[model samples]
Target: MNIVVGVTGGIAAYKTVQLVRLLVRDGHDVHVVPTDDALRFVGAPTWEAISRNPVTTSVHDDVAQVRHVALGQAADVVVVAPATANTIAKIAVGLAGDLLGTTLLATRAPVLVAPAMHTEMWQHAATRANIATLRARGVRIVGPDSGRLTGADSGPGRMSEPETIHREVSRMLAAGADLDGTRVVVSAGGTREPIDPVRFIGNRSSGRQGIAIALAAADRGADVTLVAAHVEDAQLDAAHAHPAIRVETAGTAAELGERMRALAGSADVIVMAAAVADYRVADVSDHKLAKEDGAPVLSLVENDDILAGLAGARRDGQTIVGFAAEMPTDHETVLERGIRKRRRKGVDLLAVNEVGWEAGFERAENAVALIGSDDQVVAEATGSKREVADALLDAIVALRSRP
Candidate 1:
């Protein structure tokens, strides 16, 4: 594999040296492209020594050879380590005068960005938009983890470790990213059933799990569409920043049902992670009802079950995975809800978890039991949302491979 490692001017420039060394050690054809500003932080000597190839800061170095064009054409993957806010902005706006940016523009190969900047810079609106643009272009983002960054600040603006970046880079090369080649539609967040214009019934879903699954699918090389509804602020921010995902928002189960039905014929996988309302107001008032009265005098109607519909109406070979936020007491309760949900929904698998005491929804950590239609525990794993997503996807792929 040929890798074009782009380094920028962050304190993380030093880490890129180790990153290049690892890629070389792993037997990848490594090419180092560092910005002029990056050269100040870590000179060409280091990159040259690590990559064993002459490093150039600009396209002027080899005018006849057209280095940017050649490098981009040959790369299997292009990884930008410690992508500073400046570079991210430039790339976002398609400013390609620089060697690295120009080569990035020229490549058909997958691009992965590892961002590192000040916390304030990371949170800026413009920076946020730039990240979103990059993600929508199918660029993979690794991390700016929570820790000490340049100066006396610390947050999520520190670049991920070289080892982690290397692993992700290798994974991208292995994925052979099937973006635009295969179709996948994933529903996320909780749907709101309108009782009035001002308020409606909603669930305690943050959509973190759904975002994790979308990101994980991208990492595994699939074209994924995320149907996001009633998403939380954080999840919305992250989803907005992801450039690769096509997002559609819905406020009611009926709206989501319509969207699902439209995509039903062509999808390869449908993950129903949205916590849709079981009942909706039969008579939706045009105006918010004045606070007066007993029982709220609300009439109810059954909302369509989006998961079962997807499982039943989807074209052949389309896999269905459902999630349930079961507020359970004991392990038996967990098993019962999981088994019942799996069978009742006719889904290939059900991801069941307890959410009353912070076992799943709105929490940082979650545990889940994957129940297959056969009522057997195919796989069980627990940790952060990312870890649980991995377990869930593993189970999905396994279930899919079974005869």
Candidate 2:
């Protein structure tokens, strides 16, 4: 594989050296493209010696070969390590002031960036918006892990370790279309039950995990139907662009159920990842309730169990999967609750994750345990949502492969 490692100006540039080493050790043809500022931190001689490929930071260098575009055209993947906020902003807007920028613009391959900056910069609204834009365009982001920084600071601005980036790059390269010819249906986001014209009841599901699952399946060559409820346009961007994924929208639990049922029959695998409300207001006001009429008596009714209903109506040979977002009680573990729910729903698999005020919902990362039909824990994964999605898919692929 041809790998392009774009090193940006940051104190963490030292770490990217090991990342390049790992890729070269794995027998990949590595080309190092460093920014002029990056060379100040890690000299060109070292990169050249480690990569065994002549290193240059200029589009003007080797213009005869059009090396700037040539490298990207030949790359299977492009990785940017210690990606400073400046570089991120540049990439977000397609700037080509330098060799790295031109190469990035030239590549059709998957681009992965590992950000490293101060906590304040990482949390800045500008940086956040830039990251979102990149994600919307299908650029893979690894991490600016929470930890010690260059100074007496410790937060989520440290670049992920080199080994971690290497692992992610390898996974990207090894990804295969194993799910080709398979049909998958996934429900995502939190359903909303209307209270009035002005307000509604909803959860803090950003739909990141479910979107990740759909993206993973599509990447593996599956034809997917994604039923999304209340997911933001930004959150649905990649899915909408995926050729293999057909997206549908729903506003409430009932509506989501209706959509899922309509799509379930033709699916080889059905995953219910939406956070459906267990109950909804019995009465929905046609107009906003007045302050004078505030504190009106309200009644709640239990919602239909969408997952269970789907499982019960599943076609032959179809696999049904459910998600359990449990806040485990004092007497029961998350696993126990997950197992119980799996049996209750009659799902072939259940992915259980503990959620609370600060954990699980609306977060970029997730930790999930996969419970199989045999009532045993099939797999446990804790990482970015995309990683957990792939882990669960691994189990699903394995389960279907069994005679």
- TM-score per prediction, in order, is 0.66, 0.74
- After superposition, which runs of candidate 2 have C-alpha atoms over 4 Å from their true positions? 8-31, 37-74, 81-96, 105-168, 283-294
Give each model's clash number. 5, 0
Question: TM-score of the candidate numbered 2?
Answer: 0.74
- The digit string of per-residue lDDT tens for model 2 on 1-403 reads 9999999999999999999999999999999999999999999999999999999999999999999899998988999998999999999999998999999998867789999999999999999989877765557889889999998999999999999999999988876466888999999999999888887888988888889999888877789999999899988987998888999999999999899998987999998999998888899999898889868676889999999999999888899999999998999999999999999999999999999999999877789999999999999988778778888888999888888
Off by over 4 Å in 1: 6-22, 25-27, 33-43, 49-53, 56-168, 176-180, 215-221, 232-244, 292-295, 330-336, 357-359, 363-369, 376-391, 398-403
Residue 249, model 1: lDDT of: 83
The whole-model lDDT of each prediction reads 0.82, 0.91
| Candidate 2 residue 210 C-alpha distance from true site, Å | 1.8
Worst ten in a row by lDDT for model 1: 174-183
Give the Å error, residue 1, model 2.
Answer: 3.7
Candidate 1's TM-score? 0.66
